[model samples]
Target: MEDLKREGFTLVNGSLGLDLKHCQLVLRKIAGYHAASVVLHEKNPKCFNNFLDNVYSTDCLDDFGPVIRTIFKNCVDMISKWPGYGTYVDTLRSLEDTIVSHIRKANERDEAMYNVLNHGDLWINNIMFKYNEQKQEVEDVR
Candidate 1:
């Protein structure tokens, strides 16, 4: 994360919309991080594999497609019973389908692509925001 930040990364508290400059700074950082990862994965497969774990591999799921479908199906079903959390659950179900499709496609292109060190919790609340006056936007963030 420090490396990513050094490369000009800044994460926004999604709940609080930032100025255009702030948004651009955050995007550059994110793009840099993504680019670095792709480069590293291609240049040093062993090292990359050593530091990552596949979250959506066939080994982890008996049948990748079915497992993904089942998870989404479960989410849809639960949404009906849990009215308070249903909206969130339903949204997640939609995301699950998208994520699964991406995983499947990535797997076909590069079987190792699904592996990465991911922060399991990635929600609006987990983030905090601050702005940089000199830059006229958001800068430092975690």
Candidate 2:
């Protein structure tokens, strides 16, 4: 992010080194986004529910559940090439469960917080950082 650069965030330009501090800043921003969404939902219920009902339809995933399960199962079967095969399979199973849980929770959360706009994607790549002149490393992240 240009703002981060102006602020004092130094980008390594390559994967040769880890930017721990910058990484933390990004993580914090992500957490803040999630928190903001939660707060927004608490403030507005009807709008949130309407948006969820209209936008994120469970029909999509549900209709495709068999396909997804098959893909996941195939991937799990192939993962035996790696060590701790059983552990990895267990983790994969847990991941599938988590996905289902998240979908259900998201539907409920959306209904409760229909006031704020729902962001389907709020990940690192969606955000940009910029450098600030006043800071040496990373300045402001946008």
Candidate 3:
């Protein structure tokens, strides 16, 4: 792993609401990373086959199901205590049983479609950005 901190990159924690410009910069870099991976895979088809093996398959999701549900429940509980958020809490609680399955389904790769290297667990905390001199523009990402 790269020492992003040493490179003056910083990650925005999940709880903080992300501004549109920061979000855009992060997404643009992610898209570029995905695109670059695709090109690399095309150039050396055999090199990427090892990575194509499903490390996060349905069985793996099953392993994480309880943990996922617990986190979901915690989120629901947190929101449940908040005034005027009852509707959202109810919706989240109702989906607890199926959320893991839904995620597993979405993660199922379609062989017919061209697949690139997927950043499987991407979240706000996993991305680090480096800003310009004024700290107003994101110039690099990791």
Candidate 4:
């Protein structure tokens, strides 16, 4: 972390509204990380298997299923009351079951391709970027 700071990388200071370039840079960095992990797993399955054993599975969300469903229900109810948001509410309702099932199946160990390392929690706060001091361009991300 210190080395990253010394290299001009910083935690993003605040919300970046509609910043497509920055968003793309972050996505690219994440993609690279996943791709590298996939390659490593392919080349060294035993080591990768051992590494994955230490990581928590997404099945942990099973314990929060009720909470998730409640949140979605509340969101749908609130949004449904708003004018011109009926479509959004309907869409959310339509996808709710599918979303929950996907979450439940996400940690299944049968799919080797799905076992690659990934950022389980990706959000603005978890991302960091290096910026070119003079040009203000995104130099790197982690």
Candidate 5:
């Protein structure tokens, strides 16, 4: 792995929300990364065979059900007080039983469309940005 710090690149704090400019830069880079991955996948799908490691890809993280339920409950409690969101709260409660299956299906790689391995969990720390000399503008992202 090339040393990004030595090459003048920097990482942002994942705890804070990125500014619109940085968010745009990160999106452009992610889009480019996905586009390149699609080409690589089409040329050699075997290269992606070992990349099937997602949270919902297996039952290993099934223990997280209570966590998910609590989150949904908090969501419902927070939204139940909204003027016109009572139905939405009920809907969220109703999804507790089948949401995990939906998540599993969504996490699966769809080979029909020549699905490339996705880096969809795009957290702030997962990206690196290089700024200009004065650190005013982002020069590149990785």
Candidate 6:
């Protein structure tokens, strides 16, 4: 907390409506992180495997399946009701099966393409920005 304060980064209060520049900055940072992890994994597969071995498994997904489906269904329904969102709603509904398959495949240890570590819970809350105080532009991301 003190480090953040010293760096002129305060926890942004209330809801943030990120503009295009903020989104681009965050995407670039995340992409760099992912690329670095992929390179590290390629350089030391054994180390990556050992690291993953100690991580939590998704065996509890069986219990959470219903909840996940319900959430997705609710999202589709809500989006469908919005004007000009029909195409998006259709695309989302169609992708439900694909999403489930991807999730399952993502958990498979044998899938080399999915071996790289990723931020599994990326959201606005998990990101911090160091802004240029004078210009109020994002200068750094953490």
Q: 84-104, model 5: which lDDT tens digit per residue?
A: 888778778888777767777
Highest TM-score scorer? 6
Candidate 4 is scored at a TM of: 0.74
Root-mean-square deviation of Cα positions for candidate 2 versus the true structure, in angstroms: 5.6
Which candidate, 5 or 6, would have the higher TM-score against the true structure?
Answer: 6
Model 3 misplaced regions, further than 4 Å = 1-17, 79-90, 121-126, 134-136
Cα deviation of 4 in candidate 6 (Å)?
2.7
Q: Which candidate number has the best lDDT?
A: 3
Best-to-worst ranking by TM-score: 6, 5, 4, 3, 2, 1
Residue by residue across 4-98, what tens digits does model 3's lDDT show? 89988987667986788877877887798789987897798789867755635548778888998999889899999999998898788889999
lDDT by residue for model 1 (11-85), tens: 555667666765565556556666777777778878765444454544564357677777777767877687587
Candidate 1 achieves a global lDDT of 0.59
Model 6 global lDDT (CA atoms, 0 to 1) = 0.72
lDDT of 4 at 132: 85
Can you give the TM-score per candidate against the true fold? 0.43, 0.51, 0.69, 0.74, 0.75, 0.77
Worst lDDT window (10 residues) for model 5? 111-120
RMSD of 3: 3.4
Give a tens-digit lDDT track for model 4, residues 66-131: 777788778888999999988788788886666666655665566535566767788877777888
RMSD of 5: 3.1
What would the per-residue lDDT of candidate 2 be over residues 22-121, giving only the tens digit for each residue?
6777767766776787787677645555565532346667766666667777787789567767777877866664554455555654333333444567
Q: What is the lDDT of candidate 3?
A: 0.80
Worst 10 residues of 1 by lDDT: 109-118
The true-versus-predicted C-alpha distance at residue 96 of model 5, in Å, is 2.6
- lDDT (Cα, tens digit) per residue for candidate 6, span 2-89: 5776777655542856778878888998899888887887787677755564223456665566667778888899999999889798
Give the distance in Å from residue 52's predicted Cα in candidate 5 to where it truly belongs: 4.2
